[model samples]
Target: LQKACQSQENNRAGLGADKKEWIRTEDILERLEKVSDDRIYRVKDALRLGVPVNSVKKLTNIDPWYLMQIKELVKLENELMKFNIPEDIPEDFFRTLKVHGYSDAQIAWLMRVEEKDVTRQRKKLDIRRTYKMVDTCAAEFEAKTPYFYSTFDTENESIPSDRKKIVVLGSGPNRIGQGIEFDYCCVHGVKAAKEAGYEAIMINCNPETVSTDFDIADKLYFEPIYWEHIEEILELEKPEGVIVQLGGQTALKLAEKIVNAGYNIIGSSFDAMDLAEDRGRFSDLLKNENIPYPRYGVAEDVDEALRIANEVSYPVLVRPSYVLGGQRMRIVINDEELERHVLSIFKHMPDNRVLIDQFLERAKEAEVDAIFDGEELLIMGIMEHIEPAGIHSGDSSAVLPTYSLSEQAIETMKKYTAQLAKALNIKGLINIQFAIKDDHVYVIEANPRASRTTPFIAKAYQVPFLNIATHVMLGSKKIKDFEFEKKLEGYAIKVPVFSFNKFPNVDKQLGPEMKSTGEAIRFIDDLNDPFFRKLDSERSMYLSR
Candidate 1:
């Protein structure tokens, strides 16, 4: 019996070891073709484990040249890891790493130091990046397009004009939470900046966006929205200010880094963004302002999560902090579900924490997109979601000129939004979500940057809200300076468009996480028009499919 038990234990241990080996092999192969959150680390791990390039190529089916390039990078990283930070580092070593596309964040991790230390060292060494122009004709003609790229070279092609310039950092990529809506805002922001007599410069890496179009701005930087890349551009162009609000959370996340490096952020301050995104700070702000919010608790472990779940009374809306598109957000109704979900999340994201809020069942959700300059507030339009509060606003069908909200409720929402904006000192655009439960309004979430509904609100009201918000950010116009049509002649319905047919394996259920890839808009003069309403519904369904 003892021998039998030992055999079983050995088999289990072998199975566990085999699974880990398979995962390591799979992860190394995955890093070759597509980028993962920890692709670099995985590559480094495979190299350290002495995985052969031929083996990686066979598994990943990637080209040998690319594999060799990655191997070289891994070698460099290994060599750099041996050096003591301030003592043994070479003078040109950092520049060499930067030339090979190594980000400061990665170097900081290797050196066991803060990213700010790397930035400070690079600045102290005067190892600056040069900007090269992306003339549309490839230098064949005097091209009017002012696109630029960065490199470690001697001469820079970018020529600063006499006109004041404002750099617009674009939303990096079209992901679930942030899609083309932000790109639309960036494009319009460039136009508005140009119209306001400032040279508009765009910085983005997404080729799929209109903001990357060569003609959209006076100068376009086809580069990643990394702190290192942005710092180079700021040094070269010396723009009057940088606008971070129009680009979604991608740009907003860099506000503090940019500001700490002594770059001027034109619109909403970094403190305002922190206040809105940080759960504890935001909770305190709401408490001080006497604003109503759902009961909530923050947890970093399963015990804390369970405690919070029990305190919040069973049904709780739980999500991780500092995530976009409500990633990994779930509705937990029992301790079992909470434990399972929390364990799964911790397994995947060990460093991240969770927030649990009392779920407001069957509440009506409304979104307000408003522009706020320091002194004045312009409520663009109130949108009422067709679905309940649990569904993400991006995935829900929303109607502008709110179909169900009462005048009193709308006024209350506006008042709350204005108060929050004022308290945050927001200068450009702000989107706030409110839940109406038991005839009381509760603030759900607030995004100080441009929301996904900016374009929808602009089309519904026939006002250039994006452009107006840009001007507001540039301090060229106040909210009251521009006139917006108070009442819409027709109601606009913004329906989410899904690509379920393209990805048959994905579940087709609406939840807090945004799943829709795009959206379609429809207009109706009257909601009571049955024939038109039916046609509109059919069109919306067809488009969504």
Candidate 2:
């Protein structure tokens, strides 16, 4: 049991728990080994945190005599430094040195010891570094399976068996502002469905993600989110609804494929998602709704892209039609860079259907993570980026209760966000990013699917957006039936973690592109603790680093 506990302790480290609970060794050794009084007296103080001898013997079934010898040796070796002794000192001399501090020459004169005895004792005290292999069984015991993870709540919901099965598509990997946080939405949807007695499925490829954990959904496909593969799942599951809105772009892009294949889209309909994205369509929405947006032009070829770029002016933003993790998005500062980027994006897409828009300079970036039951607009949390508009939000240090924006700007943000959610007919979570300059607010991007801030806000605000979305999809929830009067008063930071340094020679840049592998959530309320907050933000206590 001692060995078993130690094995589990080492394995638990992978879970990213800060200040892990540790064990002790002396008590266990003394009791189990039954050491002679002389040996015990010689080496007792050197042992670290561990179990008692009886407990160790009860757990490992090792003989007491051998354990005694090992324990005594460990004690003698470890305590050599404590006695102010040299590395060459023999164990017998430990008693002499403990009584008095001395150099090798003085000890040799009094105890008839060799000068080299001091050196030997110090060397024996040095222990080799030990590395433990992670025990897979620890995960098996602590983690949930695909089915049970969906029901985090102890309460149960009553639903008919005829209810349509719904599965939320998953955003595969970690990106700045994104990561396991996206799965918070995924888990929410699953739990909602399960509570309402509906089957919830999740389709994703990233194994390291939280949603992929065994019990997040009723059934996890562990499949890639591509048109080819998703179409097949639609055919088999024949789900009454497919939740494209909570899964991010991977799910959003698949929405059309499902519709074209004549399958039902669970949360936001294909048309609604299209209105939110499809640069041309979104532009039309801004015009129809009288919403403010940056000037934009869709280019079909390099010549067209260059022409549109010229019209939009230098330092314009260009984005490809269907990409993930901000695959080919950038601010081209000059014609040369523009030319190279355009060619590269065109080469990546080949067809060249990209949108170029004017870059809003020096604007504060804000985001609204909201929920809608396809009717009532539920504002979960408003997230503001510390970085300016040009930085990929996922890469930016985000804060709740946006500090710098004017009240009017925040109002405009909330209004537009609600409007966007309602217009898109979103039945789940929606994360919208905006660039606000002075009194003017411009639409940056709106994801009909679960935005990166889902978990951060959910945890920060103490609201259950994911569970609500699932209930709505299953027709268990009605808009306006429930109300919330919560406001994000305190601050929360969703800081991104990177392994680029681990990948030698990796280019480090934050733009309208995502480059992050994981994130940590922290609740902060102190202005005086900004430095501590910043340091706390460096490493997350809950993340699997």
Candidate 3:
């Protein structure tokens, strides 16, 4: 059961919670595995309910050592629940809780208060974290590339540098929607910052990524991307600014918190990010700009969603705000399906509103990755999706230099992209998706930071798009500073790679939700070749296992 739970945890790390398909077959083996995992938690519940460790082990075959550990943790949680704040608890006890890996959110959960209140209480109690360096050698030689981790200690080894520094938050872990792509951006972003003569610091918990390489940044903090962890690092490092845009959704979600903590977010402001992420606000912006967007409505509950579904007619696209890789996004054909999906979405995001858009069934989908420096915009690359509008862009095969769109359509897309970048007051990278139906283009969505396609576009254009965008965010470059190629000489296709065989009994159809774990690029000089013609005609290329 423990091994099964570990396997599920690993799978969850890879696929992420958001990328899971809501509708799928119920494989008994999978169900049994899940039951095993749930039983581990059920043991915790039993212990909390005053069950004996020996009884738990007898009933659940879990080792006594593990059961005792869970019992101790529950005991501590119950003890902590008696105190309202850190100030109310003993200093040594609070320190022990921190050392025991109790996050602000977890403490707040037990105390029945907001996480911020716990954080404030900790601040008032002077219960702050300290940093210690990861000594690779046995203290025989000083580690040249010093990487640090946080702990509740008095002695600190990571001394603050007086030199100007920029902190680049890294995408925490590799998941289906956001894997190595954002790490590619972070690597380049730190290099660009270093080249710009600023000491670059990177904060990330994932050791599998190149961005977490000891040599990648001048100083690396091996820490979670949680708000409390980030705040502690920022408090210690005192960086000139923090770059949140390049780290995908994980780091992007922390932008507001970083700003509220009085740290400068180097790229687009939080308001700009919010404007792009909030569906209602973005739809209003599109309307104000006279940019065509799919008829959409925001709903806070099931009745509102049903009303919007009826008004928009059948077959609507539903998604939550501020999500990446089409997380919790669905296409429903009728009111019944709408209610089911909306209810499930609400179950996950109880406080947030769901966005409903008129599903453009057969529209050609395209996206643009561009850079903006407050005043000017440069389109990095425009990719046309081979899988049409309904499929998630991450799972779709995207061809750069837009093989099918008319020149006028391309120009119009570029214009609309620039307009959005300007309206959002974007200072770095921006990605916008569009759908073309009946020869008219409509804005699908916009992201005010680097998208998964940024790296693909950079390679397609044979330019350092990430580096250029980083410099722009650092106030070191402008759109006119570098000349771009007037025309792309070749076509670059981004092909999504899936791992359907790894997960048994999983649905294998491409849809609005992203499923691909990785991507590969194919560059071609000619599209008229017989093989290329076959690929174009079929719109898919498959490889045998």
RMSD of each: 8.4, 21.4, 5.0
Q: Candidate 1's error at 354, in angstroms?
A: 2.0
- Lowest lDDT 10-residue stretch of candidate 2: 9-18
lDDT of 2 by residue, 446-534 (tens): 87777677767777777666676556666688756556555455677777777788777656766777777777776667544574356
Candidate 3 off by > 4 Å: 1-43, 50-64, 84-86, 138-140, 483-488, 529-535, 538-545
Instruction: Superpose all Cα atoms of candidate 3 onto the true structure and report the RMSD in Å to 1 decimal.
Output: 5.0
Candidate with maximal lDDT: 3
lDDT value for candidate 1?
A: 0.79
What are the runs in model 1 whose C-alpha is more than 4 Å off? 1-48, 142-144, 347-351, 528-545
Winning candidate number (TM-score): 3
Candidate 3 clash pair list: none
Q: State the lDDT at 48 in candidate 2.
A: 30
Which tens-of-lDDT digit does each residue in 90-125 have in candidate 1?
Answer: 767777877776666666766777777877787788
Which of 1 and 3 is the better model by lDDT?
3
Global lDDT scores for all candidate models: 0.79, 0.63, 0.81
Query: What lDDT does model 2 reach?
Result: 0.63
Name the 10 consecutive residues with the lowest summed lDDT in model 3: 12-21
* Per-model TM against the reference: 0.87, 0.65, 0.90
- Judged by whole-model lDDT over C-alpha atoms, candidate 3 comes out at 0.81
